[model samples]
Target: MQFKPVVALVGRPNVGKSTLFNRLTRSRNALVADYSGLTRDRHYGEGRVGTYPFLVIDTGGFEPVVKSGILKEMARQTEQAIAESDVVIFLVDARAGVNAHDHEIATMLRRAGPKIILAVNKAEGMNKVQATAEFHELGLGEPVPISSAHGDGVADLIENALASLVNPVVESSEETSMTEMDEEALEQALATEEGEEVSQELFTDHRIKLAIVGRPNVGKSTLINTLIGEQRVIAFDMPGTTRDAIEIEFEQGDKKYTIIDTAGLRKRGKVFESIEKFSVIKTLQAIEACNVVVLVLDAQSEISEQDAHIAGFILESGRALVVAINKWDGLDQDKRDWIIREFERKMRFLSFAKIHYISALKGQGVKALLKSVNEAHAAAFRKLATPKLTRELRAAVEQQPPPRKGIFRPKMRYAHQGGQNPPLVIIHGNALDAINDSYKRYLESRFRKVFKLEGTPMRIEFKSSTNPYKDSEK
Candidate 1:
């Protein structure tokens, strides 16, 4: 893997660090709102200037003098980000001028080793003299005036940031040469194989992107730390410790996977906090982006409506799912059975997903859980042959034919795969519009059973054949 220089965005609460992050990364991945401390965790994103790629770390607000509580934790996270960064873009509010918190943060950054660039944000209309006047007192260096929201002076800011890096980005020609060498090596290997096909597997990104999601304090971050075997993400003992969807890439056995540690999702009615609302949106997006989702459920607590809602969203999105009953080590056999029963009663609709009892803290049943995840990923992308699909459709119809709807029975003819990743089987027939949801579900079950499509939700689509003669007569 090539090294991408890390750029850490550091500043006080509501100083436009996230806006600058979004500007540099060209993504709204970091939640942006008109509030102090909307971002709590360090969110990493990839940014590029021309052909040079660099990693941007969007950190929480820096309160260096904070002693206790979440602010202190956020300060620690920001400090860690600074330590890991190649360049630190210490952002300041041009509109707000230099405050006590800004001085405190600047004092801390001056002692740090990274290349610090003091940026005066929200300076779109201000001249260089006005923008630099207030910030010069901090004494980091010349202030780069920028408007993070309006994209003013951001390009120059990034260019200047990258230029200060120790290992400068390699030229495009050198990068191209390296890519050409890789392609040449691949071609030589394919030539040596002699009649064997190796094109599809070689060109594609085979990493399984798995999203681990659940309610607040359900060991989602704990599970991620256990899987990665490191404390890459802060697994603090708090309800909302994780507020960003942190993606960590790791390998298990021979398989490569990118596990997303998403923020806990609370019920919409209960989420009054603006930051939590943004966290909820980020969690949903993580589910949509990943190949499979590991829905972590609290083994001790009763299955709530919120859990079902999250599960329902996953099903609606048609993503492959695996239910992980977390913190199983703490629960006795009887309690475990009770929790399982409750889960079954509440989330019976998610019968297709594989369930596992695991202690994310102790690493119990983790291997089995990942195995199910791999199986689910495979099932989601599994190809269905048209002839086989048609045959299965005929067999299903023979076993249980559709009931008549006002003298018109559904005449199901054949089926073919319309799409994959929550595989869609489109059935062509007459009076197909009469086929109800129940019959459609029955067909889905049959196809699933025949194809062994476990850990994935399958859809059965009905396409009614139109009569050309009826149109002509009309």
Candidate 2:
């Protein structure tokens, strides 16, 4: 399989590597921070510079002589990044000039020897040339002057990096993902006669894009790893270990899945560093991209404000939802009862979603979670014929008729399914705005029950199709 050429950004702390990464990818996949050593892991994203398309890996800021703690781990990770990359962009702060840390990294890069492109960042406008002139002394050749934050001279840096790629690998995210054929289907396909075109309609990727989201250290990554049945993501005890939204695909039966593992979200006041702020941005974006979201909560802890905030976000996004309570293995009956009660009190707005108690560490109760996810996704795609929808509407009205607004008894004309994925039902009437909340909710519940839309949200829109001929007659 052809893999895209990898370009890595290597430099000392606080030198705009993540900013450069975001700019290159045209996405905020990598968290950018003003403080040093905020990035801890390798974040890979696809980007193009003019004619060159490549995979960019953003590593934690390289600290030369660190021996232990998170910094040491970061240094080790950066080294691994260099070894894997085809081209390395050594970003240095032009304002600060080249320091001992820069020399240390440059020496290592020279010995390792990838296509070294020196990027002198924070150099913009008329002073760009003068600021970059000193970097030539590092013996790496000309330093491409640019401002990562302002998009200055970034194109030249990309062009220099592109010169090294001989046969560029053009691969999509799906191709890179781990996709397996369903066992029974795979066996059937292999048994087909040679050159006889076996129909591939069975292998079609009707995969649901499910995103797992929650607060820090809530086992988001662990839950994802369990769901995919692989250690596809780094699950650590440390908070903020996952810095980007990572996508991994796998197949079960005929259902393909692209599961998105997002960085943990924390409340704004607690988010001090710039990196943490960026991580929150990445999480929100992941929710927007997904078809269904699994909001993981720590069963051991009480439901905090952040939990409610995250749940509210999913409801607002209009995505199908499954609330998975993680770390359920050790919880006692009392704790479980409390957890269930907490969800009930907080998530009344999202009563449509099904909740699953799961132990991701032990792989318990996950199969049921998958089942709920499937049902929810299928419901989102549900389409109702107009005649059937109208009948259902009439039935609903007869059961609980619309309330009179002063003198006028609103006439219900027609009903139709406008869209799916939180199935949208449009009911045309004279004064839909006057439809009381209780009646509206009653209809929503009735429709969900009739359509069997469990573990998925449903929306009912009251559209007023006023009769124009009534006023003309008067």
| Superposed Cα deviation of residue 55, candidate 1 (Å) | 26
TM-scores for candidates 1 onward, in order: 0.54, 0.54
lDDT of 2 by residue, 1-474 (tens): 123466889999899998999899887544322233534666766565656766677888888788888898688667766765678999999999989999999998998867899999998764867998889889998888889999988877787678666454455443233233344743453454432232112223567888888877678878877876642433233234222335667767777787765554443222344344334334555666688889988998887766776676677668899989889998789989998999889778778888899998998998888888888887776665555565678888897788899997766756656666667787776788888888888888887887777777778877676567888995
lDDT of each: 0.75, 0.72
Model 1 misplacement above 4 A: 1-205, 230-245, 263-278
Candidate 1 TM-score versus the reference: 0.54
lDDT of 1 by residue, 161-256 (tens): 786443555543411221112335434543453322321122134789888888777898788878878334332322332222356678765677
Best lDDT goes to which candidate? 1
Decoy 2 TM-score against native: 0.54
lDDT for model 2 comes to 0.72
In candidate 2, stretches whose alpha carbon ends up further than 4 angstroms from where it belongs are 1-205, 230-244, 264-278, 469-474
